[model samples]
Target: MTTSYPAQFLAVAGTRPEVIKLAPVLMAFAERSAEAKAALGVTGQHRNLIDAALNLFGLTPAFDLNLMRPGQSPAEFMGRALVDLTTILQHHQPRPAALIVQGDTTTATAAAWTGFLSRLPVAHVEAGLRTRDRRQPFPEEINRRTIGLLADWHFAPTPRARDHLLAEGVASERVLVVGNTVVDALRWLQQRLTEADLPASARRVLDAGYRLVLVTAHRREAFGTPLRNVLLALRDLVMSFENVRILFPVHPNPAVQEATREHLAGVEQIQCVEPLNYRQFIAAMSRADLIVTDSGGVQEEASSLGVPTLVTRDQTERPEGVEVGLVRLVGTERRRIVAEAAALLGDSTRQTRPDRPLNLYGDGQAGRRIVAALLGDANPPPPFVPSIIPTNSSDECRYESTQDRCGFQWSGPRHSRH
Candidate 1:
């Protein structure tokens, strides 16, 4: 039996979070490169931040559409990306058999919509995530739900997300509750870092008794005032603590740059450096004392690493960490953020603690589960928690292991007669 199509699949990711989560899926697809071709497309919605995550993951986008270079308003970026995506969907010689997209970002929404209109079936990873309160998370809550309307296969991270789609009238057969692939990513990075050993320069930086805080923030909602508040609080934290270094990876958005510099400049202890690659970012995460960000992915990553995270946003789509006491929400409140951060300066949850269980997401094999479901595999699958991927609500946190990963398995191959 021969597999056909462009011999590769296309994955569309625009932000750092999307790139981070999608890496596992892309790697899974890459694992099958002997039989399939996988190409990545960037909408440039995330630009610099995305590039860092991609480099860390050691993945590359086949096409880069500089959608956000000049810095467009939400309306402008969305409209432009949509038009660009439609063009990509219309062209691309020997089109991919499936398009892989993760989570809800402007880029994912546009790509999915374009794929749908092109009559190209989409396999949406991290599908069916919802906040219920649309305006609270703004376009994200809507972006994901909207993409679900047209997606052919939903690779949900939990039963809750799957149920969300079912409630919205998506067919049960089309929704598969695959655990999140992030744990796999985290585990992979953890192993790689442990094995390779850090370089002298980076290791020296880590060894200097400097407590590192990994910080990231880039959201349309947090553009002006909210951005300033968070940045100021971070700057204050650096000034207040000794040997406390803040590794703030600056996002490429002009607004983010201007706001970060305006608030973070002259703060000697804070290193607002260029975005590091995915592997490099993970190294930073691994080396961090505490993680601070407005990113949903960071919440999940920090949780898996057992690091305490202060989410700068008002709400989050991944609340699993908060449920387990691994993540806290400080929003963009300056004084509140500074106070909370100061408290965590000397303490952090140790990943080596024997008591922590890894369940809120799944064992690292989510990618496997997705492939299995697509091929109609039946295994003793873990029952997915039907709660939303918590960004800040504290609840139940069940941890699992990579050894426990049976996240995906295939019953049989589907061979089409060409």
Candidate 2:
């Protein structure tokens, strides 16, 4: 079952967030030909949404297991992914030395389990996320936890995330704070984008004098009545403010699309359109005065761009942004959502940047550091380390001397900047 070239490492991504975050990792592989060989495997869990981001980043997977079926249940889809992914790997000659997955998608979870069962090392990017209450996010919270236990390397986006892994007794040598890849992807997209590249519909909204408010809500927990309540808040906000306009890119799911159209279609100053591609979404975020979302990746992107954000969930796994005042968790209650949106909208003084830089996330070199770790090349510390001191846990981090490179060891509590 050998191929022309053995894929030294395989990156698995099925949804938009996974693809966006993994893009920089693939780029790291492409840039450093002298390092280990790498390839991508797409599960196509989000077939329609995955390609646009992949095309934007010039990425193509070696295997595309078109595993999604119409109206497929999570169990069905994951079972299919497991079977198809296993088949693909079986046929892949010289099998990948390691399998890398991102976030807490079903695809990532399935791939991690497959890798671990196959006796292959699994590296989890954006690892150690937790809401503790598994039902709040419906499977995502559990997915990351399962992967955290199964993974060989845990690339945490922040020290908080790193501490969670250490508290759970994962090997300190295997865990390292490598920042988040979403920041890397956002920075990369922001660099090449100009106004001319924005979608025509988005451009029209921007050209209008109304202050823009971006809204995106598609979490499973927020469906049904919670979703209706969120739309109700949007309606109230639209009716309350004459000068403000909202742009919401409706999710393609029938339940979501039906409810969105039913509640807010043809509403004044609110453009409820189909979902935007990553670039167009970025453009929309750029033009926005405020952002309301329940997405984990959006929290990271909005915080990195310094946009005021409101999370529509009761709890969030990504709270670094909230700590820095870049985000507020307002839940799905109508009055609370409307009140918070109104308060932030009226306050011009709150628009000023934070007094200090929020390095709570990372500086944008996570992809490189992840690669460096994967290849065991002790380079330097990640581009930016947060000011927070590492906590000494009962299971404090300790590094193996044999695995140390460039004299780098994270086992010690003392921070050393390379």
Candidate 3:
């Protein structure tokens, strides 16, 4: 647990979720200034969407790569991020001992790879999430797996996530079940939010006494027909229920905007407007009677608030919600989506809250656990007990590369598996 680098850690964030989830951990690091310093790196992949989240938590990046470009393909964007991140790490004074990236954005994946190539240990927050079928959440599924492969420290947000990493050959000792930081963020926002501070749209909905249903859908796999169908289903819900009010904070992406405009435009009891700021978005989630979205963060946030949610995806990595009956996966099929929403609407009328609040994600202390690990203040797991037969009974066999050694291979400083 000793290193040459200073008592400082590097944090990289790009998307809004990354900003939101990492903010609490960064705040914790800042509080322990005598212990460690946090150096933030913003890839600017999400630009405007990231600002509100950062501002809400009072975070300003020390290293702003400013690498976003409109209309760039994922490969193009990732390539540029990798290059810029390399340059940033190269010139960073008192180089960071570990690089921290949250979730599975291109910025996270690229930064993790860059840190690995630079010989810096990487800590992946919200690690070990998987949908099994990579294509379901294109790029993200593969990205999370890649980070798990390269990360020296995996801060899994759940016991299930930690188990996934262990099953994938990540040393059990390297993974910690710290709970999801999204819950931490939700708890933070909920404490500070009120109806008076809500945006005019959200306040109006609440003032009018309509049962709010917050909707958000902008996943790579959910584009085109899936997006269209979800919108259509929302249209059906608004028309079918007079008291149901739907608030969709449409993403700025052209595909998302065009679809929302095309399918949901002029729909009664539905407000499809531009995206809201972090507080406003939280206000919407806080006041919503039922949540409908394909967002990973929303699933965690809504469930954390005890709101019943309908996930508009075929599968979700955050299955704890689904398992607890707080979230249901109603894929993009219009009939299923409409039916689930309608049923939920009826169910919401019958019950004011879920059967009970499920603290499936976190108890609002994941930030402290993450900070303890980053500062090396937490006790390390006991030494791994390797159970493998060597191919050759020699020191070279133990020290050699995986290809040259036995079936068991050393994965990290503390990782070895059969």
Candidate 4:
């Protein structure tokens, strides 16, 4: 089936990270225009800014599973997403030969499971990224592990991730260390950018030779007091660095907005921009002198561009960047966050930029490797697979054994459409 539709791919993403990392892979399919259709299905988990990102890539979702409620729990979100995406899966004409997803989100988790049930081969991009300590990343750690088990092809981003999978027992032949696709997306965004594409407010802010210090903090741990501390640090930085322009793409969550506004409002140097489009975002990050973010994707992005990152969280899954000197885990430590950003800013002038440009992920070719491996040409790598009910029981789920997992018998359409 992979060979039969070499260019066809159904790249599913709903969260910002999934959308960002999967953008390049999705673009790969779209670039093949005549040979493929890279259909996008948004489970509406993080639809807040994804459309702008998709527009940046010049792509739109074929199906939008607007499966988000104002206040939804992980349990509620995943359950709703699964139920909704199932119907879309049933209706998608010329259903994809492969369903691709990146990282771990309820959308990815639910979609991968639905695809697995529908008997479509699921390829997990950036597969097997683990913090070892599952509790640190909330549901994501579990989601990736679950997807690792459900995914027919695991496209791991690093040897470390691949090794983690092998140590726990995934078949070596099914895993492929295809590096991270975030850089490919970043590169794509860079290539696709035009000054005209930028929002007027963002472009005006960018033109003034202001050292851009991007601040994005939205981790579960940093909700109450921790959020205030990070905000305080930003407040101090903006006042201290006169030419420093802070473009905070605040999280859509209301609490985040209120908390950030409490400390960061009415500051002249601080230009709090809306969550940028993906292409403009890449352009912004590439030009940024220093980044203060708690996002796992930003860690990888900062690493890829060699932009020094000050992580506002206490921990991260992609510490490969920190280990390699591209990022510093400042961990919401107010003074440290301020100081690190200050230090990086002090060192990086227009001329002598401290370069840490290493492709820790890969050579920006993960999608091709993913498609190549899915076609059954060569063995891929391995990722962490938990000791669940033995897979030897083919009696329970024949879909796992067959190529057609997507054609489930849904006599009536119950799930809603977007």
Best by TM-score: 2
Residues 128-199, candidate 4: write the lDDT tens digits: 788776766777888899999899888877766776677678899877777778767766565667766555
* TM-score, cand. 2: 0.90
List, residue by residue over 370-400, the lDDT tens digit for candidate 3.
8887778757433212121222222221211
lDDT of each: 0.72, 0.82, 0.79, 0.71
Candidate order by TM-score, decreasing, is: 2, 3, 4, 1
lDDT of 4 at 111: 86
Lowest-lDDT window of 10 residues in candidate 3? 392-401
Off by over 4 Å in 1: 1-5, 32-37, 49-62, 66-68, 91-95, 194-205, 346-357, 378-418
In candidate 3, which residue ranges exceed 4 Å CA deviation? 1-7, 348-350, 354-357, 378-418
TM-score of each: 0.80, 0.90, 0.87, 0.81
Report the C-alpha lDDT of model 2 over 1-418, residue by residue, as the tens digit.
Answer: 4443357899999999999999988888878877677888899999889999989999878888888788888899999999888877777777788999999999999999999989899999999888889887877999999999899999998777877788799998998888898878887887899887677766776677778899898888878999999999999998999988888888887788989889987796888888999999988887788999988888888776667899999998887667546689999999999999999899866645333223447667899899888888856555336432222223332321223221223445643210
Candidate 1 lDDT score relative to the true structure: 0.72
User: Which window of ten consecutive residues has the lowest lDDT sum in model 2?
Assistant: 399-408
Specify the highest-lDDT model's number.
Answer: 2
Model 1 vs. true fold: TM: 0.80
Q: How many pairs collide in each candidate, listed in order?
A: 25, 0, 0, 12
